[model samples]
Target: MPKRVDHEDRRRQIAAAVRRIAADRGLEGVSLNEVAAEAGISKGFVQHYFASRDDMLRFAATTLRGGIEERIATPLRVRDLLVALLPLDDAGRDDALVANAFLVRALKDPEIAGHFRTGHGLLRDAVAALIAAAQADGDLAQSVDPAAEAGLLLALVAGLGDAVLLGYQTGDEAIALIDLHLSRIAA
Candidate 1:
């Protein structure tokens, strides 16, 4: 019998390869040939999984977002949830690099922009919900607007990631900035 091919797993593998490339060389390094080589698969196999580079990038971006969502899915303190979004470790750094690449491309590609915008919206909404929960739990200042605070939090996280990527700040420093923000807002 022919070997059973798990399509989802194979797709994830290919996406992972793209992410590795993105981490090492930014968005410019993500090509079918590069991904195939990184994945130890044929270029044809990579093409079989993704019709084009953009498709592969979209898949990779979605995968990165899914990983973040999974991590924050469980109930946690709002501070912890925000910390989980930072690029404090290798995996998080890689995710941030890939995400940053896509975000830069989004400036030129409307479709890519839409995908990122949607993802950011989802994150913002989730953060807003968490803020509301924290307020209800008396852990955060009830006078703060959850939606506005969520937007600020998202902006700060994104800015911090950029700062870290650009060497303007270390990962630890970025996390500290976030921690400081949380402390100032604590009830």
Candidate 2:
């Protein structure tokens, strides 16, 4: 018999290791040796999955984007979005840390820039769609520009994420602040 293999699952676990590294110490600490050790795999195995640092970063950034999309697509009420906007929970905080770390690298790494641009554009479009839905349901102002509103929502989300990472406010307080923003936008 041969060893069982689940390539996609293994890749996901590797990327998750990358995300964890990024969250804890930023990209500067995500070296091949460290990731391999953290993932409990050999360095050669990690290299087999991700040929270089750029590939690993791309996977990590893409994973981060997938997480946000999953949140947006989940069957949650408009009110539920208030909770989603806050990154005060451990899961949210980790995601925010992973995302910002990727953003930091994307600024100077062209190999991974397309991955970031695509992920960010998709997230922006999803937010725009959410705004359009709110308008259609008479839950938000009719005059809202989906693009501009999406930008504002992105800014708010980013700010909240940073605050969460920096420990400026607890989860409940962050949720309350997000609630206030939602209230102003509600029709």
Candidate 3:
């Protein structure tokens, strides 16, 4: 009898290790050796899961996007969805760190850029739909274009996250600014 290994879990763990490294030191020098050490697993074990560093990073990016999608999933209010996107907590901060790390990489890597573009488009679409719904219900001003508003709101959220990460502002202050923006746009 041999120990049954959960392959998907192992892969996810390895990806998480990547995120931790990216969050701590950016993604420049991440390697299988470093990832294996961070994951407390053997280098051979990591290679068993990921064929190459790019493969591991792609999986990690997918995992990061999936986490964001989960946070903004159904049954949530528009404000809740927007709030979920901010770096208001430790997990959110970690996600922000990983996202920012990949953002720089996306500048030079088409595959990574594609991943980010798809995620951003999906998130923008979802937010636009929510804005449209709010407008329909008369909670938000119908005078504003939902798609344009969504794009602006997403940009604001990204900027606020950066501000928080850079110590330019606190998370609570960012949330207050977001709420103020929402109030001004209210119906």
Candidate 4:
């Protein structure tokens, strides 16, 4: 009998390799040869999964986005949810690095840009739902607009991650800023 291949699992393995490479060497470092080596697969196998670098990048971005959503899915307060979005620890730092690499590349690639834009929309919607839940639970000011606040919060978190990556701020400092923002909106 032939060995059954878990295509999704293999894809995730490849994407993990992509993330590691992007985190270590930025988007420019990602290539079929490198990802294959990192994944312990052949370059032909990598090509079998992704037709081009852009396709690999799109998959990697989707993988990263799915991870963030999964992490924040647990029941948590609005403040905690906001904090969860920060690149405060090792895993968070890696995710942020990969995200930044993708963002930069997205600026030059329309397909990648569309993928990110769609992911951001989904993230914003999720955040807005969390904000609405907080308001309903009396944990946040009822006057706040969930959709608008969600957009602002996402922007703030993204900016803070950039700052952390650029050495302009520490993760602790970024968390402190987020805490302050949360305090201001408290019910």
Candidate 4 per-residue lDDT over residues 1-187, each given as its tens digit: 9999999899999999999999999988999999999999999999999999888888887787766776688846666777788877788888888888888888988877888888889888888999999999998899899999999999998898888878899978988998899778889
Off by over 4 Å in 3: 1-4
lDDT of 2 by residue, 11-116 (tens): 9999989988888899999998999998999999999999997787777776776666656677334446546756656777777887788888888888567787
Model 3 TM-score, 2 decimals: 0.91
lDDT value for model 3: 0.89
Model 1's lDDT to the true fold?
A: 0.84
lDDT of each: 0.84, 0.78, 0.89, 0.87
Q: What is the lDDT of candidate 4?
A: 0.87
Best-first order by TM-score: 3, 4, 1, 2
Per-residue C-alpha lDDT of model 1 across residues 119-177, encoded as one tens digit per residue: 88988888999999988998888888999999999889889878887788997898889
Which residue pairs in candidate 3 collide?
Answer: none
Q: Per-prediction count of colliding residue pairs?
A: 0, 0, 0, 0
Query: What is the lDDT, from 0 to 100, of the residue 23 in candidate 3?
Result: 83
- Comparing candidate 1 with candidate 3, which one achieves the higher TM-score? 3
Candidate 3 residues 68-179, lDDT tens each?
8767886345677888998888888888989999988889888889989999999989899999899889899989898899999999999998999899999789889999
Best by TM-score: 3
Off by over 4 Å in 1: none
Query: What's the TM for model 1?
Result: 0.89
